[model samples]
Target: MTGLIETNETEAEAARKAEADAAARKRVADARKDADELAARIKVDGPRIVGELLSLARECAKQSLIAKALNAELPEGETPVPQADIVARDFGAEPRKDIRSRDVELWVVADDGRIVGDQAAVTSSDGITGHLHVAGAGLRWRCARRKFREVEFNPRTFTDWPGSFHELIRLPRLDGPGALFDGSLLTIEAAAALDVAASVKPTKRQPRPVQIELIPVDPTWPPATAAAPTEADANS
Candidate 1:
């Protein structure tokens, strides 16, 4: 009877251990399943979420800059120009007749109301038209100018570009150049691009900058020589 009781106790303990082990294995499997599902969801939604966040951030920055520009004090000779006026003058049914010569200086306003590129030429064929010919040697100006050319030449490539009123109202930066306001002018193509950018609402589509690929310089005089065959290549 004592032996039988001991045998029964041992069997009960073994059963409890088996139950615990089975529960632990089930818990691990459930955890792994959850982890896999989470990874799959992230793989599908991660890019979209990141894109939306970036768009939101850009819109916020653009609005903040615009507010700063609107509240900024003007320089002695400078006057504040409305964004609508600029658009009207450039895209109106009738062309402006009171075009100014290139000799006139129209400075680009920074977000902080500081003037940049004071020497930039403001020219117009029609008296009411204005064009800011940015000639600053600075890297920022160079990039801005290059981008303008790219958009002007290839407007179709960047149909979804974001344009802000502040960018046009102020000095155009490569990363954030906005609309062209009155009193200053951009090329018609540039202005059109800005108009497209401004009119479109922010969406999941990310605006990509025009990429200009550099052509490799062709070898002059002598062409590149081929590498000599190795011993292994000769054996093959």
Candidate 2:
């Protein structure tokens, strides 16, 4: 009876050890699968981050005009301020996708009571491109206090092409009211002649992502092909 009891005890111990080993192997396998899924997501959405950042920077630059248009309440002792035409820029796109979301303020102080017409200065990075002809979809005006009016279009539009040197330099497919010019329309012809988004360096804030991917356009693509339609003027 004593010998039998010893054998039973040894068997129980072996069974427990086997179970522990099996559980450890399963844990390793699960961890690897989780890592792979995360990696795949990063690979797919990482390129567009820079374009989003550029868009954010452009929107922040428009604060002065936006505040004036919205009739925003200044500080208690703030003087009555003049409003100027708000302008945003298309700087370039960057590669990193890990982005935080935040609000950017665009403000322009005008000596005059009303806004100045066509008061925008813009600059582009060698890696980014925005022409007067075709661009990404964005509103000419934004709802005050809700969100920024300027935007960076999705970089996935260019995924079907040759990638950029790295992530930060992708040329995004962008559209703004300024891109298309109908030479026939009087207003269109006048706008086409302007080069503000092309020339001025805008005030920019940090880049944020609404969706985790938070990527921007790839710089190397022919941006016009991926262009989508957007509102020309929000005030309209």
Per-candidate TM-score against the hidden true structure = 0.32, 0.28
What lDDT would each prediction earn against the true structure?
0.47, 0.42
Off-target runs (Cα >4 Å) in candidate 2 are 62-236
Q: What is the Cα-based TM-score of model 2?
A: 0.28
Error of 2 at 89 (Å): 21
The residue-by-residue lDDT of candidate 1 on 1-236, one tens digit each, is 99999999999999999999999999999999999998776556644553444344344444444545775876677665444423433432433344333333233333232334443354445533334544464323211111111111212231222344323343221222352233134433343334334433333446877898977587653445766779999999
Backbone clash tally (model 2): 31
lDDT at 69, model 2:
51
